[model samples]
Target: MTRLAMMLSAVALLSGCAGRGGDLPLQPASALGRERATPVDATYQLGVGDQIALAVYGEPDLTRTYAINPNGTIEVPLAGTIKAQGMTIDAVSALIRDRLADGYLRNPSVTGSIVTYRPFYILGEVNKPGQYPYQTGMTLEGAVALAGGYTYRAQKNHVFIRPETGGGETKVEATPEMAVRPGDTIRFAERFF
Candidate 1:
């Protein structure tokens, strides 16, 4: 079979295994799953501490790239200061366009993209412990893979994730195909008698 076919078969088999463990409630399927999805607002949102690039056609003097400040704002020429945090890059561009069109420029077109994603944390029993950069579509297995693939003492079954959500830690049973997030603390406990 081709690699793609082999992968699909493997995924089918693994999903079957994920279903058998029933200890944890299955989260509704996320867009992060095996299939790629298109969103109505597809651009990534700029958060506090995000680095962004901005461009203006025929107005290079007013264009610049910078990291969003702690207050989630950026100051630009003519536009002064604008809040950019919690907004998608495209939305930021549109906001700039609106300001420029209000007598700053004729039909200004603005564009922004995330140059860096803030780092998050992962810890416990993983081969490598500490902070890792945030990446979309990250999962438990994928995070473990990045951590040098579980230490010999790493428990294959009980994995814990403490996310940055600021609520509480989540303990989960690990399936090889399970997903994880950056800024999440993943702990593998030892099996006991």
Candidate 2:
């Protein structure tokens, strides 16, 4: 009886540690699919660590690549400091145009494009987990491949991701097509069996 009780207790303790800890809110995989399907409708917002290339028509001095500062702002040659975080590329371009028109030039035409996006991180149960450069249209499965795939004990059905946009980690089903955003931290949980 003593030996059986000990075995049962050990089994219970092991079962409790099988899953990833913490109460992460669950987001259905379909929701992620829907978000990716309509990428044109939702524009990508700029954030810190992103590099942007801006060009001002007929003004070579004001055209250059600028990195978004930690405070979510970027300093342009004639535009001074402008907030780029949470703003779209077109919005930033318009702001620069307006800023230049304020005192610098007449109807200054400005265009902005993303030079480089922030990196994404991966951890837990993957063969090689670390930060990797983000590419446009990257998916969860693609990220897993970059992380050297999953370990034998990894739970392949779902994973947890904390978005860079500032929100609680959400549990999403691990699918080949699930979109991955820049600066996201993805975690793969261990499997019990």
Candidate 3:
């Protein structure tokens, strides 16, 4: 379909976007057409593609950092290996703290932050449509920019957000302020004019 047509048609699909993780909070990056946006739990689950930064208070020896393995685990000094998938960031922090307190270190404090959210896909009408990482609070316009902006044939009037539910309920007036969820499929259509 033409860029304008794709945009116009896709805008009508936002109302139907859904994701796969039934219990997981739906980030804009998650695939669509199955579930609604889920809330982030107090703890963060370590995923395969997730990047993390770890720190310990006053203990560089015990405070090392690493990304979770493709299998959803990480390697540490004393802790050996730990599975982080499905565990909240807080949960991971506490585990580290306890491990350190248990002879690994003296009254160690552990903390971790998610450094990467992984890649989400965008197709149809974007200049470089494909997979892009999910940055916190990123907007539709920013996503488009990452994809190399709209094509000359892009329909500037309406952009559709397909959430994997196979369609959407979003209006034609979606703006840049709208949060770009993970796994969201944005489509730009051709203008009638």
By TM-score, the better pick of 1 and 2 is 2
- Judged by lDDT against the true structure, how good is candidate 2? 0.85
> What are the root-mean-square deviations of the candidates from the true structure over C-alphas?
13.9, 2.7, 10.6
Candidate 3 per-residue lDDT over residues 27-68, each given as its tens digit: 332232223233333543456667777898887776665777
- Assess every candidate by TM-score: 0.65, 0.86, 0.60
Name the regions of candidate 1 deviating beyond 4 angstroms. Answer: 1-44, 162-166, 181-193
Model 3 bad stretches (over 4 Å) = 1-45, 152-173, 182-193
Alpha carbon deviation, residue 55, candidate 1 (Å): 1.7
Find the candidate with the highest TM-score and give its number. Answer: 2
**Model 2 misplaced stretches (Cα beyond 4 Å):** 1-26, 33-42
Overall local distance difference test of candidate 3: 0.66
- Output the better candidate (2/3) by lDDT: 2
TM-score of 2: 0.86
